[model samples]
Target: MAEKGLVLLYTGNGKGKTTAALGLALRTAGHGQKIFMIQFMKGNPKYGEIQASKFIPNFTVVQKGRDTFVRKGNPEPVDLELAKEGLNLAKDILQKGEHDLVILDEINVAVDFGLLKEEDVEDLIKFKKPNTTLVLTGRYASEKLISIADMVSEVEEIKHHYKKGIPAQAGIEF
Candidate 1:
């Protein structure tokens, strides 16, 4: 098997960015490779990562964001602190090199929102292990990140339930 490390950037203004990262984690885990996922800008527990954590031993999912979602026009100080903590944890994990694959879920959103600095991310990318695959997922990927990434995927939003007056559904949208 090939043992080359790669930077994967999943961006765009659409859904399934995190889902795609998680799918890669599951696939890697199936191959007996340990996977670690750090979630930024996410606090709710009613999601796929929580469900996967129950049965996947090799999968470690950590949510460092606030317990409540950050909404527009009313950002809380705690949200920023939580995002910082999460980013720090992710950096530590990336440096540890214990896992075969590390997924920085929704990290781009955190960076775009100014919760984490771009320089810090660039540093992390620089120090990643030679054989450790790193996957970053979120909308609005920065140009610097795209330049360093080995592969980039953009999810386009063409249509959605929100536009049709339908609320987000459990196990489908969540």
Candidate 2:
């Protein structure tokens, strides 16, 4: 068991938010710690992280949502259901102490899009185990979440190839 766990938040309007969390996942799994990732608002099987997690012993990645993008204020019913399901699973995993690290990938964006309530996310944190570090990633993190997190990192995008009309390539952006 861990001595203690931290609530880490990775947010901002830039790329690499999920990448950073997956990097942490790799580190945790490398240390022989069990890790679970609930990728909300992302359901692509071809993502490098998803494929890589398959090879990691203690790393489990579950993707929720469709390949299409969720509209800001017009999320579908299925989107809401998937996000809620992911949040519920995360809460259960955290409470059960089955994983040393739990990463809620793109959960901040789910909250921002109204697929989840900030209070629900708060409840998950409240039920977190002492030894389970919870990492929340994605853009538009709430102020309340930042206030409560033990560590917060915002990845700002100065420039990107996407802005240059370059498509998101596999292994790079998936």
Candidate 3:
């Protein structure tokens, strides 16, 4: 890890964005670093990461969104409200200098879906503490997000089992 922490953005259509973020969280936790993961647009309790998180000490995970997928350009009031709540929480988490790493999972998708304003995300990046590594994970990462990131990785998907009619499995795809 960088001495001053690093801003990392994981985006693209491929799977493992969140998986990579969680892998970071796990690695950080193994080293006794605190990690706070705020999952935007993910209210599903069945995700393997969420369940695995229960066993990791100092690894806090919060899911803020509806279980059902929010339609693009036609989100429900609840979806908007939940995303706002998560953003507010993110602000507080960043300002307070609480955790070593803060992961905003699926936040880019939230912005793309109009559940969150891009300006607010820019603010999150701007206001983050110097020593806090902020990790944003999700598809459709905005240009602004790419610009602010100290490290950016785009997960490109050439092939996926889901394309072959393999449903999302619990441990792998949840």
Candidate 4:
């Protein structure tokens, strides 16, 4: 079989981007493929990513960006720094060619929020390993990214509990 990686971009206004990627990661890990995840725009320790890391071997999950919810107008320097670190780690993993799949979780939000530059993302895409599948998740994906992706999935929000003033529940949301 030809060992080549493909780019996967998941974007939309609704939810499930990260969840989709996580599902993919779990599937890949079950097949004995190494996986790595870099989470951007997320700092909460009580996330599902943390729990997955505990049992999954050959998996690394890094959380960067602010712990608080993102605001449109205000972005702190710490958030930017954390995002940069996450991007750098993703790049390093991609270049190393160690993992079979690398998930840039919430990268679209990072790029949209201006924490991660589009140019750097483009460079990562350009230099990615031949057999390293890359999955980017978040809303507001860039046109350039979409064009390069082998598979693009958009999770549209038809209905959400948050709209009805329901808080994010554990296991389901996290």
| Candidate number that wins on TM-score, 1 or 4 | 4
Ranking by lDDT: 3, 2, 4, 1
**Against the hidden true structure, what lDDT does model 1 obtain?**
0.85
User: Root-mean-square deviation of each candidate, in angstroms?
Assistant: 1.7, 1.3, 1.3, 1.1
Cα lDDT of all candidates, in order?
0.85, 0.92, 0.93, 0.88
TM per candidate: 0.93, 0.97, 0.97, 0.95
Q: How accurate is candidate 4 locally (lDDT)?
A: 0.88
Assess candidate 3 and give its lDDT: 0.93
Better of 1 and 3 by lDDT: 3
Cα error, residue 40 of model 4, in Å, equals 0.5
- Name the 10 consecutive residues with the lowest summed lDDT in model 4: 65-74
User: Number of clashes in model 4?
Assistant: 0
Which 10 consecutive residues of model 3 have the lowest summed lDDT?
A: 1-10
Error of 2 at 25 (Å): 0.7
Clashes of 3: 0
- Model 1 lowest lDDT segment of ten: 66-75
Instruction: Write model 3 residue lDDT over 123-160, tens digit each, in one string.
Output: 99877898999999999999988998999999999999
Q: In candidate 4, how many Å is residue 91 off? A: 1.1
lDDT at 127 for candidate 4?
A: 68
Top-lDDT structure, candidate number: 3
